[model samples]
Target: MDKHNYKSYRIEAENICVDYHGKVALYDANLRLKAGQICGLVGMNGAGKTTFFNALTGFVNISKGKIRINGESLRIAQKYQAIAYVPQSEGIDSQFPVSVWDVVMMGRYGSMNILRSPRESDIQAVKDAIDRVDLMELSSTPIGNLSGGQRKRTFLARAIAQRASILLLDEPFAGVDIRTEKLISELFIQFKNEGKTILLSTHDMIHVREFCDLVLLINKTVVAYGETSEVFTPENITSTFGGMSPDVLLGPES
Candidate 1:
């Protein structure tokens, strides 16, 4: 796609602050994500990673500052067409009796004509997304029947099917098996190769170091933001994680 045709900056968050109830979650966080890059947001628990994701996707109303996608500020409803967000939840209620394919099909609702039902092409896109995530065989199964990793893959398929330019994933690998994690990492690389910008928040420093092109360290604020190696240094990691040794968290550099 031509540079002018596609968005220049996949997503930009400028001086954004978010509050839940009376407490502040993210404070003046600024971020710039480019097309075709996979970036990681790392921080300890309660450090505002998810809150930042919510703010960027407009899921949570911002207390201050602005967020833009493709140079345009996005409203909550409008954001669904441009970005795909996968929260940390394992899966929706298993007893709800939703099929995996149906769940994936929901991703296309953002762009679908509300007056009309989904057509054959939409079904094909859902199938393609399931295949991309290697869930073709299980596409007919109940989402509740799948394992934690499989559930993650299902949501990833949904995001892929959305055909959004930007993806925001919150702890996607949490509770997932090692094999699923590897598969998800490979899928992320494929998305990057296709020029889709990806931003993910996780505590998995090892995967972040290995896969992310850029790293943003957050602790209710922007602590360090730059290349993965540079920001993952002992001092920076220690400071961000509250005096925890980087070696222990990063697992003895290469």
Candidate 2:
């Protein structure tokens, strides 16, 4: 793990590019996020949102550029400790036998030394995370049997337990109801208030505008990035999505 004593940008990626085989997925992407900000990662389908997250999380090797957390250069091996990722719900295996508590505990497992049991602090963290997500009653439930919202909350609990300063969430509200969406949004707010830097991918512009302090608009590359009010305009949306329906982009008011 490379280290740099740089100053306080919580998350930064500079001139990032990723290649899948010989095909380019992202190009020259640069993003910097401060602590305590909820930034929305929004783009059309197949627009490399997931690819960018993968690159940031070290799941995919970046062909060029650097990612840093709290001023330290991020290495693939250090990604687990530096970031916690909540992937899309469909990615969760319905047939997996793990209980919710077990899944949440796995988050803390990375921070524990190898061959050593979890410390009291780790156990407490897991419990607090579970309670924070309002899943204490369902903690012992098999993850497979939980509802879509419950599953989403379970994974969120896992991320909270990881206690990483930076969280990368991919389509966290995809399958849940509006009520559940509101609940998750509140959790993000709480995390932001606590000074966690969060980057979440979502298709809902309404939610993006409502909760995100900053927004990154991308389509295989960065189209725009800045305060939500500035970057999420119809013009930028059109540019990013290749003229998506005005009705869809602007809603009824436009």
Candidate 3:
């Protein structure tokens, strides 16, 4: 695709509504995330951050509204193939008997036919992703033996191997150390420079301010969505977090 054409790889949600058992998790949320932007999702627990991501990634059925990717409206099933999601590491069973290599290759399964084995290119992609995340030394290690940061990097490598235009991450920085967090932050910037779109949910306002270009504040609905600087003000954050001040949440540096 032409560079100009590729720039249109944006995500548009029109009045998105998600409900569970008659309870609204997301209500009439509408937002447009442009290509190559890293959008940070912020809201209190139970305020619908994960719910919005689930609806956007098609993990849950939306009660009402529509989503368009690159100008084409798509159903939930179709959206799955169009985006890559790296859910929280806690969701993975650390005891699962899988090697780092095996875990990363799962990302390629979506592109393969049923009952087919990985081809040479798939193997190479997995290797490249591992190397990108500086996991070559641990590539053969079992996932159960890896540290929390290593496990997070392993999943990030998997997402990179998927090569999707849109990436969704939930709490990626949760258990990571400062160095690993910096590495992941740099990787996100690299993805952005390569024209990929990213939406990540995080509670750390500091990282949100430092890493994300855009911010999506949700409190059962979209309280604000725009450039990080504009949407992360004390007023908007207070609207979503309730009783919290931006200075206290973001700290002095932010």
Candidate 4:
């Protein structure tokens, strides 16, 4: 596809396919996401949620197809730090012994000098991100020691500090409490209003129905995608999850 075709979209994936050692993960996945939109990437387990996110982050190789971010190659955008990725918190090493401040500060490293030192702006950015997530009081505490919710906020702050044009979040709200969920949702909405693009993968039907503007359902491939109000129905949900009840996706809708 031509680069000009990506002008109207914040991110675009055209026929993207990824495989690990010949085992297909994602096949011919196509999506175009615009700014100020929160897209929910939904599917059952091992159905390519994380694989799709990895494709966006350029962390995995694409056997075929193209991905453009900010109208540039994914690697170029990544090199300039135009994208931020917050992987599943459960996959993180909570015992890494880094403080909340330390974790957030790393986001600024991309803008630092050869020594990777922090300047006033970097410090201020980290501080602002931490404060925005309401982690100001625990800024000095070790991330490994925080509750599950706090840890999620800590990584989210890191992503915020980058001030990227797009954010790829993997199950960020999983295992979080109401307070944390509220804070995260608020931030997501705030960013969306600011014309930032956010795509998160999750099984949280509540979040999907309540917050997402767009929904992309994938069962190892693109099944359905459109406005959340339109494509997020039970029929599409069951089809995407291979006949599984939508309730089973997140334990019977309250």
Candidate 5:
């Protein structure tokens, strides 16, 4: 990939810093995500992954730096319509009387006017998203009733429906079964093929190695960021994760 392709810079962060209350979550964190690529943000628990996501999505105010999309300065409105954030927890309330289809349609609320209801095209988009995630059978079912893996798929479908060029997914594969993980990996590939930029925070190093074109190792600050194979070295992994090697941590499954 051309390192300085301005057109490919879907998302760019310059010295981003965030503090929650009195605690610093991220300090001088910088990253750039190009189009048609899947970049993995890997770090241990409490490594400021979600904090960085919140900062990028404008859900949390940053103390320093600027985040831009397509070379334009980022705004909350830009974040709403141009960026899709899939958090670790499925935000859908299982007990709520909302169907999976309805949940997916909610993603379009950012673009919908107050006076207008969902158009046929909007409905079609929702259907297409559900189909993409293989959640068509459960489209009419309650989201709360689905298993953990199914819940992840549902949120991914919601992101797809949003039609965002930049997708930020946090721990999307956590609690998911092997099959579901594979399916999500394939979905990432599909997104890449469509020229979408995906930034996912995950603990699955093996998956990162296999699927991600780039990897950013972050722990409050960016330790390393580059091609997966080059950045995920034994020395780099050990430094990032306190001496735990991939073979010991991920094992043969990796």
Candidate 6:
């Protein structure tokens, strides 16, 4: 764990490359995001959006280059649980024997002892997170019984309870309703106000434009990245997704 300081950039990746066996998933990838920012990670399917997130979390082997979170090396940052990740809803099994409270409490495991016991502070954190997500009424509900939006909020509560400086969210808006979308959008702004850096991948360009001031566009590699106003254009979208307009992806199934 190198104690290197990366200034104000809460998340930074330099010349990263990911190889799945002999197949290269990502190459020549680079990104830097400052604290108090929301960045939309947009790319085509199988274009390495998840691969980039995995590289940052050290869930995948980085074939080359480095990533830093909170100005420290990714390995060290990850060791301290510096980043909180909320993966796509499809990855989680709702049939598991877990309550909303049970899932939120998992966030505190990183701070607990070998027995994984929860302290008063941990309990309070979980409660506060659940409250923030307005899920106190359903806190005791089994995950399998929750609706799509409630399930999404439960996982978001988990991330909130983790209290990490950086958050990586994959398609948070995928299965949510209009009210849930509004809640999430508000939460993003609140997180930014708290100086928490967030990077979320979404196929919907409308949400990206409405929620993020910055955007990172990816194809096989990062084609363009910067302020959304400048980088998110017809030409860049055309380059990244190959002739698909931003409107075509706004459908519910896209």
* lDDT values, one for every candidate: 0.85, 0.87, 0.86, 0.90, 0.84, 0.89
Q: Which pairs of residues collide in model 6?
A: none
- Residues 23-62, candidate 5, lDDT per residue (tens digit)? 9999999998888889999887878988889998888999
For model 2, how does the per-residue alpha-carbon lDDT over 111-166 read when each residue is reduced to its tens digit?
Answer: 78896478999889999999988889999999989988889888889999998888
Give RMSD (Å) of candidate 4 vs. truth: 1.8
- The C-alpha TM-scores of every prediction are 0.92, 0.93, 0.92, 0.95, 0.91, 0.94
Estimate, for each residue in 122-156, the C-alpha lDDT of model 3 and write its tens digit.
99999999999999999999999999999999999
Q: What local lDDT does model 2 show for residue 180?
A: 70
Q: lDDT for model 1, on a 0 to 1 scale? A: 0.85
Please state every model's RMSD to the true fold in angstroms: 2.9, 2.6, 2.9, 1.8, 2.7, 2.9
Q: Indicate the residue-level lDDT of 149 in model 4.
A: 92
Which scores greater on lDDT, model 2 or model 5? Answer: 2
Candidate 6 global TM-score: 0.94
Cα-based lDDT at residue 104, candidate 1: 93
- Worst lDDT window (10 residues) for model 5? 1-10
For model 3, the local distance difference test gives 0.86
Which of the predicted structures, 4 or 5, would earn the higher TM-score when compared with the native? 4
- Model 2 CA deviation exceeding 4 Å by range: 1-5, 76-80
Off by over 4 Å in 6: 1-5, 245-254
Error of 1 at 72 (Å): 1.3
